[model samples]
Every structure is written in structure tokens, then in C-alpha cells.
Target: MPLTDTDRGAMLSVIGASSVDDLFVDVPEAARLSGPIAGLPNHASELAVERHMTALARKNTVAGEVPFFLGCGAYRHHVPASVDHMIQRGEFLTAYTPYQPEIAQGTLQMLFEFQTQVARLLGTDVANASMYDGSTACWEAIGMARRITKRGKAILSSGLHPHYVSVAKTMAKYTGDALATSAPTLTAETDIDALIAAIDGDTSCVVVQYPDILGRIADLTPLADACHANKALLIAVVTEPVALGAIRSPGEMDADIVVGEGQSLGVGLQFGGPYVGLFGCKDKYVRQMPGRLCGETVDADGKRGFVLTLSTREQHIRREKATSNICTNSGLCALAFSIHMTLLGEKGLRDLAGLNHALAVQAAERLAQVPGVSLVNDAFFNEFTVTLPVEARPVVRTLAERGVLAGVSLGRLYPGEDALANGLVIAATETTTAEDIETLATALQEVLA
Candidate 1:
């Protein structure tokens, strides 16, 4: 049933083309690949392909296999087996966006619960279903602020994760918004006064990371007050949602918008993502929020039900009037997050957070004993920064060779910044053990020696 060359020639003639290459006339020659991609085996059997892929997979040193400490944004936390089992149920696993509320009650109800959980956890009045991930949610918060405040400027805190900052800057470039970012702070604390000074009349929002990239926890009340005085919105970013269980909610500090990564909850790192973005804001600003919102209702018989409350994306509205170009929610990942949170009720979450902090303290005390290492943060939640005597990147490599998965190197995040080259960001979840801490400390001592 395949078309022959003569048939192809006739089709090309009908389209007024001489050859297959003519169809690509709009593509510049320099941008085109010269030939087939290198290193691709030709027509391998299924068995051979499986073998090759397995061999490639073996090269990765998984977190569970080693004494792992690496946490910059993504983390390694224990996901209960029940979460996986519940999410994999046929009803939830293959479900898509609940565009038709009548037939999609189950999906809509789950999203409603997800929104409720995120709203309560963040202490905000309302939360959308979910966004792509934490970084995109951060970018959308900036845009929403601009809409609400009618301003063009945003101030990014120095302690914000570099990856999140980059995503915001990229979005700003096309939207023509001004992003004034502070220089990276390598110390245990953020320069709050500098952030306050940066806010002015044209500022739309001030973005600060709670339990920021370096793992230092900051009370955003003063910063939030400063932003409100300038008629600017305060956007509090949380990279680790689990921290919310122990710390004061951003809403309590009067933040106008709260955005964060939900990866640490039910979601696994999965080699950087397929993660969920948690977005919540004040009730007054709900109309301007990006993504979808689900709400509970009563049916004809007065039975409870759920429906899509608001969908402001272009697909559901006039393209010119849409609140966001983001089309859909991360439905499955959000389901996983909600199920996990349900398993760990308020008390369970707090207990888990406390255990994480206790483990982190043990790791910090052990690491501080190493001759060439110094602890950076005076106060931290489940993670802390350490200053090593030598560049941390090479030391991390050496540790890996010694069969230990050490923490993330600051130099890896902020490349070419000499001041941060010796900084290391380490984390300890409930999964971290005393033996793991000892392994890291021993390996670090030997490496530095």
C-alpha cells in the first residue's frame, strides 16, 4: 500500500515542487543536519535494543543505591507504597483533563481536593488545579502580579534557586518586563535590606524563596510589609512544600501570591521532573490566576459534586483575553500529590517534617567535624549549606568515586562564580540515615585530606 517514487513525483508536481528537498526551502541550509545522527545502531532486534538500553541505564548511580544527600530543588523523600497503589488505579491512571464536568466527576473531584490541600498547606484563600512545575508557576505568578498591579518591574531575591530565576528571566525577555535580580548570596542569610531597597513605584512583585536555595529559612513578614507599602505584590516561592508543615505559612506573612514545587511530596525526582507546581493566591485575585480551578457543588438531588470552576486558558476563552497560554493542568502528578498528602494528615506531615529536621541536624553536626568543612546556615529546616576548603565540584566527583553520593555543589548551580565554588548544599529527609551521614563525613574527610 506504500506510494512508489513515481507516485511521490506526481504528488510533488501537484504541489509545484521539484523534489522532497524543495519542501524545506524555508529552513536555512546552515541549520540543517548534514547527515544521519552519529552512534545510532541500524535496525537492531528488540532483544538487542533492550540490552543496549539496560546497559545505558546501569551507568546512572541512583539515589537509593548510595549515601545520597543531593538536594537543590528536586529531592529524595520516602513516598509511601499506598500513594503509588492508589494513583495507579485504572480510574485515575488513564484519566485526562476533566473538560466535561458531567462525565468527569471523579477527575474533577480529585482536582478539587488537590486544590483544597494546596490552598490549606500554603494558607492561601484559593489554589488552581496545578501548573507545569514550580518554575513555570513562579513565572506565571510574576505575570499575574503585573496584571493586578499594572506594573512592569519584578525584584528577584538572591537566594531564589538559579533554575527558577532563569525560567522567570526567559519569560520576561519575550514579555518585555524588567527583572531586577540581586547578586547570588553565598552566606547563611539573605540580604533583606537590599531586596527592600530594590522595590519602587514600578515594581509589580517581589519574589522571595522560603527556605531558599541555600536551605536558610527566612520570615517574609518584613519583606511582605515592604512590598505592600510600595503597592507591589509579594510572591513567596517554596521549593520544598514539606517545610510548610513546620514553618509558618506564607499567607500568614501576608504574601499576595505563593508558588512552589510539589515534587517532594508524592512525586519522585524522576531525573529532574514530570513534577507539579503548586499555585495559590488571595481570593480577590482568583480571576487573574493561571491554569484551571475546580470547585465543589450540589447536584439536583442535593448530593455533592465537583466541576471546573474556572478555565482561563486560550483554549477555553478568546485568545486575546485569556489569562494564561498554559492549556492544561498536571492532572496525574497532582493526583499523586493529593493522595500522598491524604495519607499524611496534618499531624503526620508535621511529624515527618520534624524527623527531617532531626536527621539534617545529625548530618550537619557530623559534617562540621571534618577538618576543612564549615557550616554556613545558623538556622535551617531539612537542608543546610557548607563551605568546603576546596572547590566542591571536584570533591563531589571524588566522593562519587568513593561510593558516596554527596550534596549538590554550588558551583554546579552558579557556574564560574568563584565565591560560591567551595559551597555545597546538603539535604536530609526522613530517608537519610546515621550510617549515610557517617559515610559522607568519612568520605569528605578523606577527600579533603
Candidate 2:
């Protein structure tokens, strides 16, 4: 039933509240918007609003309309038709977080399968249901390491994504922790020795990115050992999980925590967000982990089932004791990742990863043939940086006008950081074709000329 004015008034009277304004007495009046925002129309019919948004959307150029090569954190990978159809089967789409174990077997089982898949892919013992996205997952991982080691300092590699580093800095500032991050390295590989030198007794974790921001792949075995020797944890962040199929798993190298973005598996880029954060760690440290966890069990009837096993880290557990304020999982996106991975098993994932690498190499080689362009990283999976004679930003803008979504500019990722401003980071996923590579090369030649 729709609530009436009398119903609201009676409820407020019972609580001894005079009005809605009285309920917000604690909120500062100066901080609140006085009325409707300026410039925006006061109100509009639902149909009119839909029409306006639709018209605006039509004016924008979508990835489907062009040969897309832009991949920094998000990639343009092919998702199977069956996976999409299976996820929207009403049972999966219309469900909420599986808080009730008995009635939520389906969701719990899916999350359990997801955790298993992530654990296997990352080569870790356990994984959570999911987190907000890759950046937050990295941030949480630093905190997790601190709690486990009872230390206050974190050492971050410069090759980590700028946004991820920024998030970590913000989180550390709030917690009164110390963070030492390296300056951005333009070369392909990370300086493991330099990273280890920064670690001290008070260091809780050493954070490094696999297939880092510049698309340089680091083995991370030596650095992981150094952290362990120093009584610190190694938090490995993988922005592209697909890179794992070809590269060594972080766990094999003694990574205490492995976090990544699972968007490449099943989720679409969807502008910038709604991506899944992949978090996995050793079984021993599961209690210190954030977010929800699903486990296998048997009911009184002796039937096998899945249930929410560990949930002591959310907001409901009291702010002071809670591991994190993150209460919900990116259930639907995680389901998409699981569905896609299930469709491709182990062998299929490896083959797909190989294809992406080959495609990227082909693209990089072709672009290198352009008079003034050169590939920066000799060791990369599907994404690599290119040194352009001219600044990459204006060239990218010109290519967009020519209907090719070329690649992301390094300047965009590191705005005032001028050293990398001339370099362009290009990615080629399984979706990229020979023709796409040719188109990009041609656009660069023309734009540079």
C-alpha cells in the first residue's frame, strides 16, 4: 500500500519528531542544499526525462561503432551470448546478497564457485565474494596486511596504477599509516631491489602490480621473498586478471594477498564502473579479509549446500570492530565473471590469453613501423606503452574524429607528471583484429604527419 500523509505524521509523532527537518537536526544547515539545484529544471515527466537521456546517448559514439583499442584498467573483451542469457534468468538477476543461508543456496553456491575460480586463477587458498573494484580491493589489501602483521608502514611500487596509488594514499592518511611509493618508472620492468630497500621493521606490506600500469609484467618472486624476510606481507594487485593465464600466479611467489579487477573475465567496461574487485589470500588470513564469504556445508537433512560462513567484517558488526564498511558484494558482475570462466574452463582461458598477447604484439609491431612511433615494453601481455614523437593526446583526439578509438594517453593517467605525457599506452584484447591494428597504425601515421 502507498503511504499516506497521515501515516507518516503518526509515525513521526510516535518518535516525538515534529517534522523531517527535526529528524535532520544533527546535519549542518549550511552544508545542505537550500532547495532544488540551480540550472536544473524543477521537475520533468518520467517519459520526458527518458526521451531527453535517450537523445543525449544517441549523440555519443560507443565502442561497438568503432575499432576500440583503449584499455588502461578496463578492456574490450568478448563476452559469450550464453553467459549473458544465463545470468539474466530471473533467478540470478532478481536476487539480493545471500544473507540467509537456508533460502539462498543458489546465490551462495554461485559465490562459492566464484571464490574457487578466483582462488585457482590467482593461485591463492581462498577468495571473498567480491569488492567494489580493483582500486578499493588494493586499498583493502594494504589494510589487511597491516592488521595481520601489526605494522604501520606500507611500501608501494611506482608501477602501480596512479588511481590505485591515490586511493591507497587516501586510505593511509585516514588510518595514520606511513606509505612509501616510488616515482613513476618509464621503463618496462619494476626495480625489485629498490622496493625491498624501502621496506623496514615497521613495514606491514609491500604492494606491487603485476602487468603494471605501463603494461610491464613483473615476476615479483624476489620482492615477495624480501617482504617475507622482513616480516612483512606482499600484496600483489593484478589490474588485468587475463594476464594471469600467461604470467605466473602471485601466490607461487609468496604473495600474502592477491587482489585484481575481474572485469576482463565477464563484466563489460560500462563506462568506468560497476567492475568487480577480485580479492584472494591465504586461508590463514581469511579472518582479516573484508567483504562476505560463502562456504560449503551440510544441512540437518544430510544434503549438501552453501552458506554465508564468515561475515564478521561488515558495517553491521559495529564500526570500531568491523574490518570494513563495505557491506555488499558486486553480486551480478561476479556472476558474469563466473559464468564466462565456467564457459571457458582452464585450457580455454589459456588459449584466450595467448590470443590476446599475439594480437597485442601484432598491433605493437605495426604501430612501431610508423615513422616516429616505438614500442616501449618488450615484456607485456596484451597492453604496452608506445613512445610517440608528438604528444599522444592530440593524436588520440584526431584518431577519434577518424572513427578509431586508438588508445589511452599516459598524460591522462598522470596529468601533471610530464615525463610520461608523450607516451601512449595501447591495449589489444581478443576482440582486436588485424584490421583493427592496421586501422590504428594508419590513423597514427596520418595524425602524426
Candidate 3:
């Protein structure tokens, strides 16, 4: 398949170019490479390339093979085989963006159902098809709130995931908005009073995480009320969507917007992504929501059908007027999420959430028994923070070497913060078992001792 000098010359002639160098005449001569790049290997056979890639992949420590407990955003959950099989159907797998309503009914209908399911789960009036992921969705929610309130300031709760806060800050810098963030507390509890006090007339939205990064669940109703009194919007973030099954939804808590990572539902960690984002909001703000919205309607024959009702991305409208510049939705991942949710009905979801909580409680009890360990939160879902006698990062590394993937170290996320040096965030999902918990407990104890 490699092109010969004759083939290259023929192609250049067809394109009316004397040489390949002519194609890049616009690029600065100094910027262009003088010759073939150094240190790169020459071409190899297919078998040799495959062997090299397989060897590299083998070096990774996959979550399924270890006593894994890693979770800040991505989580390890049991995805039903049916989800994969269903999404792989030739039609569903190959379907692109459903821009044509008449020809893309099947894709549109699936999206409609996905949106309905997300709306119900988040307790919002309407939900978009999907977003890039939870972090980007949160950033978009802030933009939507700014559009609604016509404000310039966004107040972020310290308990929100640090990664999410970083993303918002990055977006705000380019958009010429103001972001006021609080410092994380020692006890890992959200400083609700401070967040309320930070609100001012110029505040557009207050973002807080439910079962926050430390896994402490906050009652957002009071915060929502305070934001409303100040003419600011309350945006609730849920990193673990399964917690919605066992706790109050953001809508029930009067939050104006709810955004979250749906990876726990049907997606695997995949070492980080290819995850789905869930975005929903109050009925009145549906028009400002980003991404596509699928709606049900009657055709000329009086038969029911689905169509892309609201597409507020730049591709569908004027660039300045579009709600977001996101070009498309995560259709395949959304299909996987919808299928997994359908398999786990209300009762099944509740049972799964309960199981995750029970496992976490058991792990917490065991970890607390360690000589110098203390639980950080009294109220939490399936994950929580623990304070250790020494810095947590080294302890976690030691445990990993001992064949137990303990958990995330807070110091890694908020480096150079003295208060968080000894803090560790641990998660126990339904996939965690008695044996795995015991293994983690024993390994952690040994490392700390």
C-alpha cells in the first residue's frame, strides 16, 4: 500500500502541483522539518505492529483484575451483556447524527427515550440528548445560567470535584467571566454558609456536588432557596448517578439545573472515558439547554414519530446565537446507558444502590478499625474520605504494590495543600465484594503500620 515515487509524482501532477513542497508553501520554511524526524522507527509489518501494541497493553493494570476502589468521576460497575449486544446491532452501530428526522426515526426514538429516562432520573422537566461528559456539561450549565440571570459571577462550592472546578475555571478564563471558588475544608464537609455568603447580585449560579467529591451528601434545598432569594441559580452535580436511586434527586431539592456523569450506569471505566454526560433543567430553561432534544409528534398519516425538536449547537444556527458550540451528542454511549437502565428497573436500581451503600458501610467500619485512621464524613453515599496518620499518596502506592488498588489520594488532586495531604477518598460500588473489601483493609493496614 505504500506509495512509490512514481505514484506520488502522478498524484502531484493530477493536483497541478510540481512537488509536495509546493503544497506547504504557505507554512514558514523555518517551521517545517528540515528532514525526516529523528528517533521514529521505520515502517513495520502488520504482525510486528500488532505484537508491539499487544505488549504495551499488557502492562496496564486493569480494574477488573484488581481489588479496585478508584472513583472520583469514572466508576467500575457491572454492565449487562445485553447492553453491548443491543448497541452493536448493524443499524444502531452505524447510525450517525440523526439530522434527517424522516430517515433517522430509529435513532431519534432511542434518543427520545434516553432523554425521558434522564429527565426522570434527575427530576427535571426536560433533559438533552447527551453531552461530552459530566465536566463539560457542568461548564455548559454555568453558561446557561449566565444567559438566564444575565450575571457575571459564578460561585463554586469547594466540595465539588476539583477536576470539575478546574474545567469551569478554564472555560471562564476564555469566556471573560468571573469564578469565585472556596477552599476545601478539613472535614470534607461543604461550607454551605460560606457558599451562601459568597452570592451577590452579580452571581449567575452556585455549583455544588451531591455526595460531593468526598462523598458527603448535602441537602441542596436550603442552598437552592438562598440562591433564588439572591436571584442566582443552583446547579447540582452528581458524579455517581446511581446515588439518585437511593437519595433525593436534584429537582426534588429545587435545583434549577442538574448535571452528572452517567458512566456508572452502563459504561466501563475504559481507563477514563468514552463516558456519557447527563444534562437536565427546569421546563422554562429548556430552550437555553445545550445539545439536541428529541420530541414526539404526529406525522401526516397521524402516526406517532420522533424528531430533533431543539438543536441549539452552532451547526444548526448562527454561531453567536447558539446555546453551545458542541457539534454532536454521544449517541452510542447514550444507547448503552438507556439499555442498562431498562434492564435495571426501579426496584433493581434501588437494590443496586442499596448494595453499594452496604458494601461501603462495611468497608468504612473495617478501615476505621485501623490504628490511626478516622472517617471524615458522617453523611455519605457509597464513597467517603478518611484521614490517615501519614500522607495518603505513599500509602496508596504501597498498597498498589501489595496487589490491592486502594483508592484515590486527595493530595494527588490538590497537590501542595497541607490540609488534604493525609486524606484519602475511597469508593465501594456494587462490584465490590466482602473478599475485596477485606483485601483492601488488610493491605491498607499493613501499609500504614
Model 2: residues with Cα > 4 Å off, grouped in runs? 1-38, 43-47, 315-319
Candidate 2 pairs with clashing backbones: none
Give one digit per residue, the lDDT tens place, for model 2 in 1-449.
38898998999999999886887878898987778799999779999999999999987879876889888889989999998898887656633577677777777888999999999999899999999899999999998888899998988888888899999999888998888875576776566778988888899998988888888887788898888899999999998899888988998888989999999988888988789999999999999999878899899999998888887665557778878888787889999999999999999999999999999989988998999998889889999999898888888888988899989998888888778878998999999888889988988898888
TM-score of each: 0.95, 0.92, 0.96
Q: Which 10-residue window in model 3 sums to the lowest lDDT? A: 89-98
Score each candidate by Cα lDDT: 0.91, 0.88, 0.89
Question: What's the best-to-worst order under TM-score?
Answer: 3, 1, 2
Prediction-by-prediction clash tally: 0, 0, 0
Off by over 4 Å in 3: 14-18, 25-38
Q: Is candidate 1 or candidate 3 better by TM-score?
A: 3
What is the overall TM-score of model 2 with all chains considered together?
0.92
The digit string of per-residue lDDT tens for model 1 on 163-247 reads: 9999999999989899988556677667677899888999999999999889988888999999999999999999999999899
lDDT of 1 at 202: 94
